[model samples]
Target: MAARRASHAGSWYSDEAKHLGKQLDNWLSAADLCHGPARAIIAPHAGYQYCGACSGFAYRQISPVVVRRVFILGPSHHVRLSGCALSTFTKYRTPLYDLRIDAQVYRELEATGHFEWMNMSVDEDEHSIEMHLPFIARVMENFKDSFTIVPVLVGSLTPDKEGLYGRIFSRYLADPQNLFIISSDFCHWGHRFRYTYYDRSWGEIYQSIRNLDKMGMDIIETLNPSGFTDYLKKYGNTICGRHPIGVLLQTVHSLQKSGNNGHKVSLKFLKYAQSSQCCSLSDSSVSYAAAALTFE
Candidate 1:
């Protein structure tokens, strides 16, 4: 099978190996390492200049975990589909290296009857999962054999479909070898994003956006899928990856119900930031955040 090429390389991040390597190394170096392993992580899927550093904070925590298989759940910005689409490509190409796709796991998942094996072209330009590869490749070099990924793109769907997919994927979480990476960016404030409500004043819009993100983060920290959905129902926080995150929480909650203790599953807030702090203009800003799900 033909591999999906890096479509967002130069624009979103470095296209050259040396430059990309150095850039990623810098981000990883700057982050403070977490004490333990992370079963899952929620990171930003924006341009490097905007959210790369914030993503680094979460990836740093993932670096310690020596898992052979990673399950990546990212929001689909371009496509709209029910359930989740798993990439059928043999590998995902990147400047750093072409990371292999976990074909065995992909086949197993396909056998389960939940995910549709998407055409390679469907994932060509999607940055959500592609953006995280270089970081994983850079930080996870300790693996003797290059780790493979199972990339799943989640889209808008009915609540029943959401819960169905959630329960489907939760079955795999029983294995400690399977790591889940949820790609998401927090809030898109200001007029450019058409999410404006508050004024453009730095202090006001900044604080308001941060407060909104914190509310969402509080729900995530609780690891309560229903609470997060309620927050979304009450006030639609513009979290781009809300669906994927919801699936993750639902998966965790499902495990909790089936004799898997909930106390062992918890979240750790890593970092949060505004796009204005990076380089975006003040009139419009997108918030970014990083967190890890630890199952002790």
Candidate 2:
């Protein structure tokens, strides 16, 4: 009966239920939903105040999916994980609701002996996966019943291991009842994040940084899985969730090869913004892009 409590609620987002509801409502209200039913989404996992509105662009696309479960794949910032870490907790607590863990799916995934199961407490310090819960809760709140979640903390993996994990997920993705939410921010620039290769004071240099983000986003929006990975390697994009997004791309590619009829997918770039654009701070900034992948 134990639950994984929200650790960043008050600071990262609103702690009070009503205030949190209003915050989410405002974001969703202003968001322009993309043209198709979202089978998957790529959203940023930074604090709600920092990237919440950007996240709404992706969430708005999947707002209409009548899903029973969501597979949240995010990078492990605090933990150096191998393969993927599945939470052992039974529920995930947020301001909106305590989401039930998809025990069956977790058990099934674990039974494959392909992934490691964490002691559940590991989630307490991991914000990448937890930060998306409230947005997901608010987006799916209108559904008849609460949906379950399978929180997967992705880590470093060898090519073979990555491909195997992708194959495992491809089957699940073939199902329409499930959704995948990839938590990631595009670029972390400035000396604060230790990625200071450019002088932000120079307008041209800053514009180039924005261009780099666009290049990455274009690769993702084109559904070129291999191209995305290659682009990251060529440019060393500091997208924190690259591994998670890599896995997602690998899984989708696997599904395509297997002739999964529903695997024909295309991504729509919904929005992009620099942290400086959203806040007063201009010295350092993290770029965020919201995109949705829809299946044919």
Cα lDDT tens digits, model 1, 1-296, are 77889999999999999999898888878888783377889999999999889988888887445687888999888777777888868888888788888888888878878778666567886889988988888877667265778899998866667778778888777667778999999888765666754534536667767877888999899988788888988767789999989888888878888886555887887899998732234477789999988887
Candidate 2 achieves a global lDDT of: 0.82
TM-score of each: 0.92, 0.93
Candidate 2: regions farther than 4 A off: 63-65, 144-146, 198-203, 277-282
Backbone collision count in every prediction? 0, 0
Error of 1 at 41 (Å): 0.2
Model 1 lDDT at residue 282? 49
Worst 10 residues of 1 by lDDT: 196-205
